[model samples]
Target: MARRIKVLQLHPDYNIKAHDFADLGEQIFRALPPARFETVNAFLRGRPTGDQPESRAERSIYFEFSDAQLKGMRIRAMWQLFRYCRSQRFDVVICNRFKPVNMMLMLNRWLKIPLCIGIAHGFGEYDRAYRRQQTARLVSPAWRFVGVSPAVRQYLLDCRCGFTERNTVAITNAIDIVQAEGLQLSRDEARSQLGLEPHVRLVGALGRLVPVKGHIHLIRAFAQIAGAHPDAQLAIIGAGREHDRLLREVELLGLQGRVHLLGFRENALRYVRAFDIWAMPSLAEGLGLALLEGMSGRLPVIASDVPAMLPLIQGAGGIAVAPADVEGLSRALDEYLSLSDEQLQMKGEQSYRYLTERHDIEVFRQQYLELIDSALSEVTL
Candidate 1:
């Protein structure tokens, strides 16, 4: 019989933000072979009152701070992580972000199990200058560090860690594309369900409405598009602080009727199909899953020519415009609208083709399993 691999996933539930860990955790669970693994989770509830997370399902491990104090919470979290590690005998620990993981790494060095993996959800190159890894107190004891994008791994490689390209791998985020793609409903069908008219052209974006996401730039671009197409509308499907503020901008732009803010939807995946065009004008992104989700549903995408999309789109599929360039985005949208069904289909097909080759669900699942399997190979851990 094969040895069983015990895995513990850590998540900090704060405010209303459904961080990327939610998707990453669920996908990994779905990918792993149930018979070969046992799974658990540790959620940090440090902040007493901000906004509660949506819904949750319990697992083998649970730790909650249930109070508010930054320093105290960090200390309690570090303690709880060690206790969790010692208690569960986890063969592998997958840490979502840096903070708690780094803390755990330093604490675990004494009786290290040797299979610690840092699955980075945030891309570092977008922000601060690279930090000193050796001096950084919380570097994971993890054999491999998984970056959601090649850009992230390259950023680390440029940082000059001791291992010469031996420790990092770019595992692009994956969705259950088998269940998602090709089941696309007709635009008319989707519009009818969305209470939209046949003649109205809908441009949509999906993600948390935040400044970093650059949804505001997209709104600006859409305002320019709406200036001409009286019936054109923009629908944003996620909720955040920027929600009310963005709506205010729409009203100020005299687009109260044109821009629709559909706060977080239960079936947001379904909404991606309804869009005539999908826009991702983010200033920074680890990897644009929404872009792949939109493309899988056959929508022509117009993304910012940033690292995430530039590497994937390669100037094809739909349009790649300069970041914050509202005129460029508007022009791309116009060009897409001018294309005939066949021409549009050709662009949409490029998206589908790229996804099939690069972001297939199986590719992601296999890579994840292989990494965990290798990490847990030697130890009785």
Candidate 2:
């Protein structure tokens, strides 16, 4: 009997909830042919405090670390990962983000893992020179780099990190439409659940409340036209360090009741139906996964005009405003508000159609499996 290909997916974070990396891991594990492959997940940090979601992977291992240990995390994590990798003897090591790629490369140098694959999820992951240099060191024929978007792939190439066309490929991110559809709530139901008024038009955004997410700009934009559209409300979901700052901003803008800060919802996408339109004003994004989820929920999108977002929103029943341009976002919101209910519904339908036709999760899964297969087939033990 043939042995199943043992694969280890290395993630930098301990928690596996809400984040895109967790979603990607789940999709890959669920889609892979179980008979031909066996998968395990190894996270570098200790388990998070929140309720852990049930994982689809065969097994999961966490390297529990203390706060003091995290101060010099790279060295500690590398030592722990080295011990783990030596014991597991995985045939393929898939590293998410640059740090994990570096860790895997360091291990590969000693262990010579048959196949090592790195995934670039966003622009910020490789923004630093140290990360680029580390990536350059991992550019052997046995290593393959997967970028979550073409923009990211191009960025890798432009960095001159020894990533050639043969070693790097772009695969757009995807959402689990089946699970998302199941979680869908009726507009009225969702609004009621969130304590929102039935008559109000809600503009929704979902992401970590971090600076790069540009929630501040979105708030500023909402403030610009809040008086003109008294029936409109802005709902920002997810929690981060910017939570208190954003609350202060909302109060300062005198948008106390109008802007709702719904923090870190486990099933945030379930409330998408409550939104009249989806707004993503991120300053930088690999690809707007929230925008995709909104589109899947049949909501028209309004996002920043960054390269990562443009490909998803342009000509896809959505509008793009320049990043940090409060006036532009205000105008876009006002225009969307002005549309008739029928027009808005038509736009929503178009978004759903576009998402279904192009960004289906099955397509993403198949592409990923193909990449994995290519890597395995090309490299010999």
Candidate 3:
């Protein structure tokens, strides 16, 4: 039998746990049949802390580089990685995000790896002129580009960076629905755990407390309808620098008791069932995995009109408002609040159906398998 095709999955950090956002590395590794592929995972920055889970690759390596070391020229890091790659004779390298992709581009010119695939998560990754120039100059026939969403793939094609239709494609992000559902708490249990009354009409969001998440806008929109629906409450999960600022916005709107910022709940997806409605007012997103998590919980959804989110909202029959448009968001929230229990449940079922149809994890895994097989075939030819 021929030797198994050696594969390396490179990541900038180890922050993404096994259950998060389809667990790309784990999915890709599992997609390749074990008898045909020998898979390894590498982290350029962080190491696992405490009970932090890792990718399910056959082997794992961590560089443990400092922030400063990963910056500037990254010559030292490149030398070490080159030696490692050379020693292993990897047949394929899959780099996540810009930093790993950028480094691999330069190193591969010398290593001459038969297949190098770079995955871009969102727009603006190549916004810098230098990064664009470097990518355009170093890209070769051996390389392939994957954007996490169709819009992001188009963004790559328009960047003037050597990514072409032939070399670039989209593989929309997905979540492990079965795993997420199994981990979720029941509605009443989730509500009680979140310190919410079981009977309250809850609007929920899961994301970092960052400006791009548009939590401020969501807060303002909820404030617009707060008085009308006194029984309704808004809860945002996750933590970030915008914590204090968002709190101030809540106070300014005098929505202290009605609006909550539950900073960074671990396995926060477990609490998704507590929400009567799910809102994603993001200004930008690769594919809004959190929105999928909420849909997996069978919650009625509403999101901004941003390209990344619009398709999901429309597919699920959820409302779509202009990003940062408080009036529009408030109106959408009001409509959901006005719906009777049966109507809300129907909307939620629609959302869940759309998720399974369009963003199923099995489809995602199959696509990756096909893409990899096709890429490997080209290498042999």
- Of the candidates shown, which would achieve the greatest TM-score relative to the real structure? 3
Ranking by TM-score: 3, 2, 1
Q: 93-193 in candidate 3: lDDT tens per residue?
A: 99999999999999999898899999999889999998899999999999999998888899999998899999999999888899989999999999889
How many backbone clashes does every candidate have? 2, 1, 1
Best by lDDT: 3
Report how far off residue 278 is in candidate 2 (Å).
0.5
Error of 3 at 47 (Å): 0.4
Q: Compare candidates 2 and 3 on TM-score and give the better one.
A: 3
Stretches of candidate 2 exceeding 4 Å from the true structure:
18-22, 48-51, 67-76
Clashing pairs in 1: 102-138, 116-142
Q: For candidate 2, report its TM-score.
A: 0.94
Better of 1 and 3 by lDDT: 3
Candidate 3 TM-score over all chains jointly: 0.98
Candidate lDDT scores, in order, read: 0.70, 0.85, 0.90
Worst 10 residues of 1 by lDDT: 13-22
TM-score of each: 0.85, 0.94, 0.98
Q: What's model 2's lDDT at 84? A: 83
